[model samples]
Target: MLGAPGPSPAEEPPGGGAASALSGLTTRGRSFLAAGFAAAVCSYVLGQADLLRVGLLLAVLPLVCVAVLRRTRYRVAGSRRLAPARVPAASETRVHLRVDNVSRMPTGLLMLQDRVPYVLGPRPRFVLDRVEPGGRREVSYRVRSDLRGRYPLGPLQLRLTDPFGMCELTRAFSSHDTLTVVPRVEPLPPVRLSGEATGYGEGRQRSPAHAGDDDVIPRGYRHGDDLRRIHWRSTARYGELMVRREEQPQKALCTVLLDTRRSAYRGAGPDSAFEWAVSAAASVSAHMLERGFQVRLLTDTGSSVPGPDGGGGLSGGGFDGAASLDTAGLLLDTLAVVDHSAEPGLSRAYDVLRGGQEGLLVGVFGELDAEQTGVVARMRHRSGAAVAFVLDPAAWSREGPADAGESEGGLRLLRENGWTVVPVAAGASLPELWRAAGDHRAAAGAPRGGAAAGHDHERA
Candidate 1:
């Protein structure tokens, strides 16, 4: 998000009056004024004209500087630009600030500071000696965050001080810029994803000449119908113009589901099991999109990315050609700020999966109870191929590893349902697990279930 225009430095003070001007006096300036007053009192008691003159000069100088600074109309504008506005966690991004002195008068020493979140690092500060009339100055700083989220930078604070350092006034611009720190995406080796290429264009043949009359599907002729496509036999029988319906190619679909229930995972911070799942979801989404598969990022609540139909699902309309990159970006951006949901179960995810067409399902989940396991078992029926990365409770549990027997039982149930299951432990290698999934699919062959149970001991 970009910042909006704000009040100018000179006009920022309330009513631009004397009270505001007096409040700008620095401690040193106030001290001088006090000393000057005391000296004037002593000089009057002793009737010394030289002492009186010196006291008067000391008292008036600071006041004079304040009055001059207050009357000086300063017109300046500030703009902040972020390079690579969206960055991966623990990565650095540069922020460029441009300050334009639009006023006719030369500005005095200026101190600039930009506000930033503590996680991103300390506030950036810069000092400029002066900006000649109608001059501009640019400065930049770098910020990095280990955590992922959106952070606001700005309301750029400017401190204006007199040349003599007698007074200092602080003003802040109203505009603010936003920086999105997204989850880190790991590069995965290209392994054949099972069932991802099962759609019409990839696996099925489209032929019109080989089809009999019954196999030829036709629709009413429209204004732009090609004359060559007219089916004379269907037209003659129906007594109306009919055109052969073209077989539209369908892109393979991939849905990346992330378990975000607060009770599902253990630990906290960047190393938490939940964070790991988020990163894995982002990686898989990008990988599938690059492979030209129509991808959807679904959370425990609902779809994370909206489709072309303005619904909460990915449409098949723009998954091909140049729109793939844009889709990948939108998916990553959504995952960057995804948070844990309070929902206690995976029912919502189940419904979303049930409503969509069967394709490839990739899930990153935490510990699952019997009810949750049952729900997931039902979900497998809706996908051509399903793979699940279930986090090991023992790896992230604060009390220690969970019961191994319970974990094994859940994995067995998913395997029985034809799902390729991979157990994720602390510090697990995502790419390695990804490759293992492909290996499991190849070993399983025609049927994708039961065979994966032999690999249950394998952990990544």
Candidate 2:
């Protein structure tokens, strides 16, 4: 049951409105008083005892409920918990709420509700019959959305209603939390690429020679130095404890380029082609990170996934260089709040890749025109291995022809320039579609083309 507004000491006036508007008497509360006054006047003038008694009862009934409610001071507390703190777009997440009544006296019928982001769904509400002093109650609800973003979960609203339904009071709690809805990512099929890490690490072949004249010199052993790295020859020569310092391995980096320019994609909202491109980028990042590749995520407008602490982002074309599984969550968290920019093209990404060291380049893009296709072709030459997944905006538009051939033209151009191009459709199975990409670079031979080439001309 909803209630009349009441003062909220715990909250500010919503939208900077005046405080008086926050609380007011209900229509029912006013009507009961008006009826009582009229009846009392008539009974007194007509000298009718029964009518007088009825008038008194009507006047006093609401007062009694109001007085009881006013004497009961309800001090309530609440905490909200979002399960699976991180989730993918269009997936279900559960919210758990635990409320405690810390008042000295028991609470009357209390109504509870929580505010949420519009995209996540409607505000959830519940009725608590009563809670004894120092007692608690728990409630849970589910939220599902097709949008990817970080949203705040609450500031719980509580209401107190009289048993007679004549009086009502409402209050709002000021506690809030965040929910991160990241882009949906799926597992991709196994694929092979050709590249050698240039940074540092002992690869399949061993090199006994030191890197350079400035290589790390043996010194006194440190607390954390491994005993296995102790150089007995250096220790004997120096007449003290000495250990050889190992060099960090140079791992090959895989750069995931996401096209977030507003002009590059078609449609809008959950089913937009831009959203598909983001999901593809997220999946590819996860796949590469799992394979122990240092990953870098980049977008058109220089936006990147900031670390959890909001520092140390993949800015300035530097790969994160951490190949652990834990690094995937950090990348996904950044993608959750990514929004499209007004930039016209992918020129920024192209420029950054052109000057960076050669490794692997993975491009998740939208429909490409002639000029954009050339930009991609030029960028492909700077990398040891290049793969591009292009989203066909025409396939996703209801008014456009599904068999539009621009995507095929773009794909052919990319293929001719040594880039393995894969065309993607909306709602297509990512695993099956990725597995159909037939381009592979041999260990010794040139980039070879495989036979999974039907979508080049056929409508998605």
Candidate 3:
């Protein structure tokens, strides 16, 4: 996975600008003209013919070299990388650049006109004084981003010129570096959640039904276990019976799935309901990642990827894409590039995930389909999977009729059927939504969190 993303300074489309800066250099040229005119005027005013001729030669000679030097002299190249691809809100990141001189002639006065992504605004630009022939240098810049999202670093344009400003060359460089900023995760205070979802997981062997789920490791045997868990061959060899006990279900592997079927937008207003759905997914995933859960993301509006294991979990460690601060960035980056599918529903993906309910899954969708609802119902009956919905009230605004698109009622329907419903208002923060969902469980005497719980409650 660490095969450095894209080309470095050594590779990429060779700098292809044909004197764009020189051709459009009205100001710099004007300065040159003004200086020459002053020299000529001064020479004439002082009756010095020699001085006038020298100024004319000085200005015109460099002007001619400008066009020619742009196509030759030194071969300049550049590239950039954002180390620790993922960053926290209100944090800092390093942007690295690799500059190389591909030609024999040493390159000097390299002015880089990098087209940085609008997000990382270039208040202060990049400047490379000199790069020796056959030598390369890596330069770094720091950016402080306040917003959370995935941003493209860019196709940087290397603008080079000689000391006299006579000859100039322009080349474009590309970097696969992308910055992903994730929302701050506030840890849940000591609390507990009610129901089998939270407490039932403690000290229990892998449930027979969930044994097939991926990521569930098997521990060695113990006495008084079911006959099915006994290892017969080992008993014959070692003269002692051994059985396999299921390891405790890991708290890391959490997946968030968002519903993006177009039909869910029936009654929305200014902001499309789809955007709210994405926010919900981002919020929940960010929260879980902060809590040390191995987090993965899935959204119907964009591409759906099951986040990798151990990498993004709340275990407090580095991630090689699977579990890292950039995990959220990659998720949102994929989200940014992915468009909503026109498919009728999410039945197929839900069906596939039903039997493999290994990690925690949070499904968010704007509208509810029968097939999707049915799958959720089944997963609940068998695996005790936690289900939460981010339903939009706007779907009823311009819906077929005022009563036709009511969301609260549909949300209620899911709750009645035993699915957890988090009534998320539009424009709400993801952490806020989780708090709301958690508050309800607390009110009903459900285990809200684990900071404070009894011996049995500590399992949460």
lDDT of each: 0.79, 0.70, 0.56
Candidate 3 lDDT tens digits, 296-403: 565543334543332322231122333455665556565543445686776655654554445555677666655555555554443234558656545434343224
Error of 2 at 347 (Å): 1.5
Ranked by lDDT, the better of candidates 2 and 3 is 2
Task: Please give, for residues 331-372, the per-residue lDDT of candidate 2 as tens digits.
Answer: 888788787888887788887777665667788887688898
Q: What is the lDDT of residue 364 in candidate 2?
A: 84
Locate the minimum summed-lDDT window of 10 residues in model 1.
200-209
Of 1 and 2, the candidate ranking higher by TM-score: 1
Estimate the lDDT of model 2.
0.70
TM-score of 1: 0.87
- Indicate which candidate wins on lDDT: 1
* TM values, all candidates: 0.87, 0.78, 0.60
Model 2, runs deviating above 4 Å: 1-9, 12-28, 47-57, 196-243, 306-326, 399-409, 438-460
Query: What ordering of candidates by TM-score runs from best to worst?
Result: 1, 2, 3
